[model samples]
Target: MEHPVLIAIRRAAFTPLGWFAPGPADHAPENAKFLILIGNTGPEMFRRFARESGVATKLDAWTREAVSGLAADLGATAVYPFDTDPPWPFLSWARRGGAGHVSPLGLNIHSVYGLWHAYRAALLFPVVFDLTPPSPGSHPCETCVGRPCLSACPVGAFDGAGYDVQACAKHLAREEGQACMARGCLARHACPVGQGFAYAPAQASYHMRAFLGARQEE
Candidate 1:
């Protein structure tokens, strides 16, 4: 049966990607009935909402709070992509069902949004809802003529092996990488699908700066 909470959750501006029951013998809260994978349109949409709300927190913190607020209204709980204390396995979750695939870039590529989207939150709810696995949307990587995402990185951050975090950060710190740091990853932009959903240049730049700045502080 369709749950009113799910409908309400969608109306609150989150896409429900996957639905599944609590695992066997799990010590999860008795009230938690299902795990719901949720995502937003993109970081730009989220940032706009944050700006309109007049929040003063950093973007990541602000986004988590905003999604949590929506979950609270539905008597559910929201956890973010950034959570790591008891680190959430969001990529694994997304790969398992109707969500999407782990791309050559070592990122989850949604069928509709490809690599251009952001997964803002994961929700746990106390209500029953659809248990059928969602259609794992058409994979763009499967039919691409040359798979440009594999070789588009100037620094080779993505390759036959996988994504190199340190290599990517080091490159972004250099003058040559300024373009990507200002407009988002070149490898990500090379994907054929979901160009329409790509993050705006300003939004991409904001995130790129934050990413590079965070690594330097470490």
Candidate 2:
């Protein structure tokens, strides 16, 4: 059975990706014994986000607010990936929890959600729950390689080693990138891992536009 806390989070539209007990080296909250990584896997979260009437701008602020609100009820401290004041080690946390691995595109790829998933907030609780530990599933990028993600980009933005942000941004803002803009990331779409859990077209477009907007703001 899923823990009440995780179930509550899912009810609120966030997927609890995985969890782990923080080691001494992990700079977690003083009394935090456990951490549950949470994020969106598909469009349900986006649907909820869209339904909520807000000029709250980016999904970051909204996710932080939602998770923090839920955390309070569960007596947990909610930390976000967007928190930069002290900088939370989300990537390391994800790796430790076995929820993700660094993929060729430089994005964290989940065995279940592939490149379509993203870490939103992590819940830190003082007590550990009786939940099964996440297994480090077979990496999707490994075995049977015709890595289409490497060649899917029109501007060759993702080259396994690094991503060309400027080139990607320029493409996204132009007519030539309309297919990607209208649907989703070309490279992300090429990944066969979790196509079943892929984001819906509308949700994909929103993120792409948001990405382009953020690049423009930068």
Candidate 3:
């Protein structure tokens, strides 16, 4: 039988990437014993997103409505990476969830999806779900010495030590940046892991636009 969470999100084209029990520091939902990290593995979810909304704007809003409903039905609470004046510590939770690792590009890399996957929302349950904790896979970046992801950025936005947001944004706004804008981050594209799960061009372009837009507003 499908895991309850899997079944609930399947129609929406989401999946349980991995999960973990929340500790005191996790600031988990009140009485939340488990937090199931919800996300996508490839471009498939983007197809559903496009088909349903026609327009790709306000994905967080659409996600809130969809996943929140699922949470309610499961008697759980939903939280998102995009939440609030005080953003929830989703990156920390993801690290603990066993599927995510620190990547040179400052985005979480997954063993199976590498740079292409993304966390959409998480369902926090008061009662623990019947799911086994996943074993943390060896960090893919460890074995890859050349680390092409760091060198592929046109503006050298990622310097291993930190990410230069201004440098990245400035480049993305320029006419010459059109290639990256229409595709995705050059650094992300350079990651050798999980090439098979790379996002479809349309999906990648959508996210690239979204990232640039958010940076412009800041």
Candidate 4:
């Protein structure tokens, strides 16, 4: 029994609006019926939609309900939220079950857009869609053995403990982060995949400035 929403998701995947990026793992449960691949909305789009929808007051809860409702309407047996932090217990359960991939807030090759990409939401359907996971294995960082991202930082913010957000904020405070904030967001540009996924320099600068300003406020 092919699900209608699953079909819609497949069609959406290839369309310009879908923004679908393939996942690394194959989700083939014996009872699995459909697979829905949802991609994150760009940062700009998220802001715009949130403002216009007037659901701004309840954005977070609204997003969850919308996804859950979509799954229920589609008759999906399971729903997976990719690329964002869901409840910790749900995340643990998903990991133990081998259902999907959960990415951190920092760098990843699969999404060259980097942390700048906003994961507004996602809804995975249990309808089988016959799509193959990305091959040649996952984790593009594996090929970047020297880990250029670690060295590219002007302040060594990405030390052994992932990204040093406070250090990065402090640096960006002075001279508006002349080293990495300008034409060289090192970690972001370092990503090999989705080179075309980069936000415009002006857009990047705006975000950098906002992030730096927010950090100063903190």
Candidate 5:
């Protein structure tokens, strides 16, 4: 049976990975038994939600407000993406809980949303409930004989060594990267699972632009 709190969480944002597990006590309430990891399923819904919210101008701020507001309504504490005080290990936590796995491309591959998704917020709950853990059933990349994702990158960003962040950014800055920028990461779309939830072109472009812009600022 689904926990009532989990249902309420879905009303605001998609809970891609959720489980009954205790995290660092200082970051969570006493005896926290449930962790609901929220994220954007696709760009369209998130953009619309932000527009309707009429909150902060920046995307990060809007998401923080939305997630925090939801948490407040439930009387639960909210952990944000930018929380670096204790430095939450979101990717590691997602993998350990079976909600996501490390793909050959060095990206997190979700069972239902694949790699074309983003982590937004996390909610810790005190009460435990009968629920199924989010598992990437059968590990999509494990059974595959040919790893197309590794080869799909135009700049070889996913070469065996690991993802080359600098190389990818350079390529995206050039005209050649427009295709990827418009349609999302090629390696991500090459995944056999969760193609249905792939981001629309506009959404992909928005994210790609944001990604490059952030890198430039650094």
Candidate 6:
């Protein structure tokens, strides 16, 4: 008998409120029977959930376990992670080697959340779905010559190598980041896509403070 577990996992992971809030792309699993969407809850949330689950010792391990469990239940062949180093093989292929460009909407062109979206877990099935991967030829950033995101930073937190987590946090800790603290995040909002995904200023400041450990001025 095929694994009924795979179906159960699919239902849980792809549901409207499932881990992956919105589905990304559809892929064919060589052995699995279903597909699961792992939602983005940010890095901290991922760690907390993993620790509580007790199946993983590290963030990556915990995520893998979560997706695997879902796939196993659904009789799927494999589970995949969307974020972190080196994207999934199929996703990479679909991206047509343009993985270096950050997505504008915080979601991958194939996904609704863009770069802001992340996968805490994944589940794959053996069955084939009528899903069509996004065209790897389309480049969203091609027309974005100004790169507002790079300029919107009050402290130039993004140094092209990666975000200066310390610098960003420190600035947000003080009154200088008041604008962002009162209204909404600047850098995230600067992106052309996923305007709705912008974090509220207070929320951004809270994250900045946590990352930088910067003390607020009295």
Q: Please, what is the TM-score per model?
A: 0.86, 0.95, 0.94, 0.53, 0.87, 0.50
Scored by lDDT, model 6 comes in at: 0.47
Q: What TM-score should be assigned to candidate 3? A: 0.94
lDDT per residue (tens digit) for residues 47-125 in model 4: 4335555422444454455455555665653333432443323333323332233333253224334333433233444
Backbone clash tally (model 2): 0
Task: Tell how far residue 201 is off in model 6, in angstroms.
Answer: 6.5
lDDT of each: 0.75, 0.87, 0.83, 0.47, 0.74, 0.47
lDDT of 3 at 151: 96
Highest lDDT, which number?
2
Q: Kindly report which residue pairs in candidate 2 clash with one another.
A: none
lDDT per residue (tens digit) for residues 58-153 in model 5: 567777777788888877676766778877777766765676787888777877777877677777767665677766576788886788888889
Q: Model 1 clash pairs?
A: none
Q: Is candidate 1 or candidate 3 better by lDDT?
A: 3
Q: Candidate 3: which pairs clash? A: none
lDDT of 3 by residue, 33-92 (tens): 989888887876777778877545577777787788778887888889888857888888
Q: Which parts of model 4 are misplaced by more than 4 Å?
A: 1-37, 41-106, 111-118, 124-136, 176-179, 182-184
Q: For residues 1-218, write the lDDT of model 2, one tens digit per residue.
A: 76788889899888988899898888877888999999998887888888884434678878877888889988999988888887998888988888978899989999888888899988999998888888769887887389999999999998889999999999988999999998899999999988988888888888888899989999
Query: Candidate 5 at residue 69, lDDT?
Result: 82
Q: Candidate 2: what lDDT?
A: 0.87
Candidate 6: worst 10 consecutive residues by lDDT? 14-23
TM-score of 4: 0.53
Residue 1 shift from truth in candidate 2, angstroms = 2.1
Model 2: residue 86 alpha-carbon error in angstroms: 1.8
> How many clashing pairs per prediction, in order?
0, 0, 0, 6, 0, 27
lDDT of 4: 0.47
RMSD of 5: 2.6
